[model samples]
Target chain A: MRPALLFPLLGLTVALLFAGSLLTGPAAIGLGDSLAALFRGEGEAVVLVMREIRLPRALLGLMVGAALGASGAAMQGLLRNPLAEPGLIGTSAAAALGAVIALQTGLAAAFPPALPLLALAGAVVSVLAILGLAGPRGGSLTLILAGIAISALAAAFTALVLSLSPNPFAASEIVFWMMGSLADRSMLHVWIALPAMLAGALLLAGTGRGLDALTLGEDAAATLGLPVARLRLAVVLGVAALVGAATAVAGAVGFVGLVVPHLLRRAVGARPARLVPAAALGGAAVVLAADIAVRLIAPDRDLKLGVLTALVGAPFFLHLILKSRGERP
Target chain B: MTLLALDRLSVTRAGRPVLEGATLTIGAGEVVGLIGPNGAGKTTLLRAALGLIPAKGHASLAALPPARRARAAAFLPQQRDIAWPMPVAAVVALGRVAHAGSAGPADRAAVERALAAMGLADLAARPATELSGGEQARVLIARVLAQEAPLILADEPVAGLDPAQQIATMQVFAAHAAAGGAVLASLHDLGLAARHCTRLVMMQAGRIVADGPPAAVLTGAHLARVFGIRAQLSEGPDGPLFQTLGLL
Candidate 1:
């Protein structure tokens, strides 16, 4: 488990899953034919399935998963809490609220980008609120408390929006959207989220050194010349842009951010810097695998990506809590 | 040469002043012990001096740019926190974060030297969080040592250590000073301070009550007035030893 080797291994896993995602749909296109259609765009039906249908879905899976994973790693590093994630600070919940608003008002159906745009707006508002409430130099406890308050408010508002939906179909749409999916995403969806995800990933990647210094505690890290305030800003904005754009497109995908980093931390020797790229790749792989599982496990029923991840991740979360408790004096 | 200078530095926390117009200077090749009671602002002064918090006056090192300030002084906080179970070597290597892109053989050598200095060579591969409190303290000390800054500010760096480890840790600070660096350490062990520190600054009620050589500052009158304690002072083979007799 040398750090150098871990990256390539994770990369291979992601590639395999990406390919698996492309080949695992209901059409049963051969791997060689799908690969050829993906590259050459020669056959009409194969090209239609590979290029128009599966490519965007698989690509979105990679981007969203990478975003969640990297954001999760950065959040954990900043808070110095293993359980910390993008959702803990209300980014995902706020995004879900935004998407729910779009669905409730029927704007998402009318305008293609409204859902993602409104979701990103929600994420931005929640992040701004957290920063405003916590202030620049507020300690971790204050930040977490603010996040909790924002999350509760967002969750309440979302439920209210759902309860007051004009029609039962809108309510169902809202509920299904909250469950999260990579279904029916097109190239337009990829284009919408790619820039924000890239920006967020770059910002999170830049925080490696600051995050490493934070292991010594905030005071010590500050004394070590880490621009702690700036670091917090970068992480918050990064997670907001990432999780926001993700929720905009895929609805409220959960657990990939929280679980991926936890799984890869030991492989990177618990170094936050090393975990960033590793978690990014691992996240993409997890999402792709989960998306594939959703397709295969319930082919006829649209099994949501978030549901599968939560099903797997919730038990893992419990196991971690139990292990942590056992380790405590 | 003066490595660190604080002029009229004051700090107020929660509407109450914790350090009031405290001024001190540390010269290269000096191990200065900051001795005070629980709420006497020793930790506050160190924190302000390192620019970890806002202060009324000025700290010369704190005025520098963050990168330069980090290169100039290394700080060890009162709390020993290693957030993750990172390997000991990796934790020690974190000291070079400020010196990023320049971590050549010299940085590795310095880290290795620090590990050896703190008797952590054998445990370099072990998880830092899994170690005992004393071992963790030493590991953090090793991190500071690897920082190789000209000035060091340590808040209770030797607390929870065994007697031998405490002496050994103090000797490391003394050695750092002897090598032309400067150290200002907040310590509760009066005996160790008297033996190892080149000078002592004693604070009471958010102010420096005494500042001089240990023998001049830790006298019976100052002890009674500042600490509200009676002490019996005697000269041991290693240095001046004082025993607390009773509360005054």
Candidate 2:
């Protein structure tokens, strides 16, 4: 328990932010009242809004952020590249398409909490496609290409579904999903995203040592008693589960995985164990900050998280590419 | 732990045979040097022993399957560039990951000893990406040593070192072997291999051409045939040595 990496720090931060997330909203809620409503269970309307709506939303975001961050760290460490990001290969996009499919087809309205599961299934499909097409080069660029291919296919399928649909509601919902947002999301959305994200977080963190071994190189990692195939499968499933669930709810929030993990690599010194947790905290911080910005900056406009992150991430990506190219020749 | 036993191993990489068939054994307290011309499979043979590459053969380390085969066999690959900026201590600690869950008090002591063994105690705080190539070599060797494993495999480990650094690096491997930890190192320099290693395994093209003591395996004729060059062999106070006379 080094003081810098002290578990207390995590507990304190999570608790403080968890309360902050509940307290701060458009409804002019205060900490004492929220706490009283949460415990006493007397202020029914206030309690429902606080407990049922805001609390679940905050918890879902926390879990999703943690999942994306952990998986992103594991992915980068596995590929041994700083520029590698989780969804660059298509998990998030596929998840979005999956959610879109469920919503546009009326399955989500028919079966609550199944949209994220649909997203999960789509994520698995895209991950499988990437692995099959990539041919085990296992580098960042190859994974990115595989992701792009899978994403394009999934996107086309989603667009086709929307175009063929007769309902205007379905088409508008598809457009909302395409842009990506977490607005007016309900309890069902929270339930759909939380479990998958939590499971994915555990699976990804369990591979922290394996990811560290992978930094030695794939061949070396296998030789070091890390079950490479099992780990790979776990990474794919776990990332699919997390990203799929998150995208189902949040609608394709890009580069929180990439940006948060990259930033924390420097903070935690790039050891996977330290990096994973640090990235988790960093991702939560980034998403929370972004969510707060979305609320404050454009209350009426409904700013999409995907758009904001991409706007931020694209420039960072260009900066990275330039830096990498500069270093090479 | 035994160094390694590779019984009739063959490897195919990308549908082409890299090592057709090779059988080799390394024993404890022995420094074995593997040398050959380009495409010689010197690296392949060592990799096979360590189970880095899949091979059609029986490769056994001390503790067999179900348990990890090569956990005791630490390796340093030919060409490695650190992708992330890792601190020296953390990189060295990676050696302990295999043993971390099961480590006794002894393992921790060994890690510290390995750090001191390679003279990296001072540079532990420094970032690995910042170190000089020669220093990086020492740090990597320190990592393998920290594994506290019985056998160490290094592929072309001293390729870029100056003569002094090369000799200094050889001494570290020599010290590991002297401490009853076996070493199977792939090398290019005939002189360094002959001087430091107890035995030599020579490959021409994916096959072992000669396997014997340095004096026998590194004869002028073998050097000329395998490397296609002339070389002078000498008996020094230390041991048999070689000096390469430009290409034949």
Candidate 3:
């Protein structure tokens, strides 16, 4: 597909999904009335539900999904591995660990900013560790192996923190947070995550040309006149910032990044630079659609968004592995 | 004009010298072949001179900023793996990345000319990773050609190519030199090197042992001492003919 058509189509899908998400919920509100309540504030009760309840949820879904998608594409490009994702590479898990620490210790309750801040710190550390373990010239196997180790370590720490939590309520809250959902998120949460997400998006935006050069390999990329070290730094920080903020606000939504980029790769002609923005928009569409599905499938039960994404993504990942294995052998 | 100049360049890795005190200069309208044994540091020297690794002494191209250096020189590493399934045209277009603005007509024309040069115009829209090994090698060579830089540094460029393709690729580099560009390519194929390269530099154990015309550099003494082999060298209708007889 031509880029001119693909981007607009993706943008349209996200927009339609955004509208669908706004209309989806337990309270049955007509589309026109909801739009009026959201934009015009004509009705009190519907407006409250539209502006306060659904608006923030849809907005968070868009932001979280876009972050995951962009970061995943960047990570894959940086490591030259299609299987690389923030969730798979321990970045999201590390961020979750930090968020859990904040919640279990009541740091987040006392100081709300501590949550995303510590999560960002954890994300930065894990990304640095992964890059160190899997050097720039590392192959896919080494990269995935390092990611497995880091992910396992982060998960172990998270489990330990949960097991040792002194307050039973805090433990349950942390458990719910780990399930990854956009339910009950307010505009305040959106505001808190906005700065970091914007910063991350901006940083990732510039990495397209660098990532394109890197498709040839490290030495080749460097000789192409790319500052490979600086590009690596930007990718690491950008991915960390995006994952930290997304995990802080929405828990650990897995697979959006991986699945979105994979699906859109061919459409973008598999160019890493073009894949970034396409994946961003595609991610938003997937997340919004998933959020809408959660409401439709188990509206009263409050099914988590991560559960749905993993259900779809894990099988896709398996298919990818099988396909790649066939190609290799 | 001197396109690339290295002044006593040296590289040390893990407290051992991988490339030692090599001084050379490549001028426009020249194709210089770098020939050596497996561990004789031809790759290390090319990498160090391109500033892909740290080294003592000076590589004139390495001193410039990244953008300027990229515009001045293009490198094709021995590992010719394409990470993504990008189209061949898109991969070739990556060569234009160092240029400041978005791609323009000149960039498109360069890519077109490169594809034609590598005889890959028909495969421009094909996925690069789906091509065979030799085809992929040509695609990568086309990518380097698309850069339109003054100098190209290629490592073992003809290793996987068939004899005909190897000669054709050499002719491409020769054409680049004829158009006032330069190339410094590492090769194990002494025949190809002798025929295609205007000059030859032979290295032994991290040091350049010979640097001159093919006849002068690939002498019996240099071949025996550096490569541990005896080779026959004679003139042919096309160019210099080189053949390896037996190990010394």
Q: Give lDDT tens digits, candidate 2, residues B12-55.
A: 88988888778888888898999998788988887777665678
Task: Report the lDDT tens digits of candidate 1 across residue range B22-102.
Answer: 989889999999998999999989988888888899899879989898899999998999999999999999898878674
Clashes of each: 0, 1, 0
What TM value does model 3 have? 0.95
Q: What lDDT score belongs to each candidate, Candidate 1 first?
A: 0.91, 0.76, 0.90
User: DockQ score for model 1, please?
Assistant: 0.89
Show the lowest summed lDDT stretch of 10 residues, model 1 chain A.
A196-205
* RMSD to truth, every model: 1.3, 3.0, 2.4
The interface root-mean-square deviations, each candidate in sequence, come to 0.7, 2.1, 0.7
Model 2 clash number: 1
What TM-score against the true fold does each predicted structure earn?
Answer: 0.98, 0.91, 0.95
CA deviation > 4 Å runs, candidate 2: A1-11, A109-114, A128-146, A163-169, A312-329, B13-16, B100-105
Question: DockQ of each model against the real complex?
Answer: 0.89, 0.54, 0.86
Please tell me which model should have the higher lDDT, number 1 or number 2.
1
Q: Pick the candidate with the highest DockQ.
A: 1
**Chain B TM-score for the candidates in order:** 0.98, 0.91, 0.98
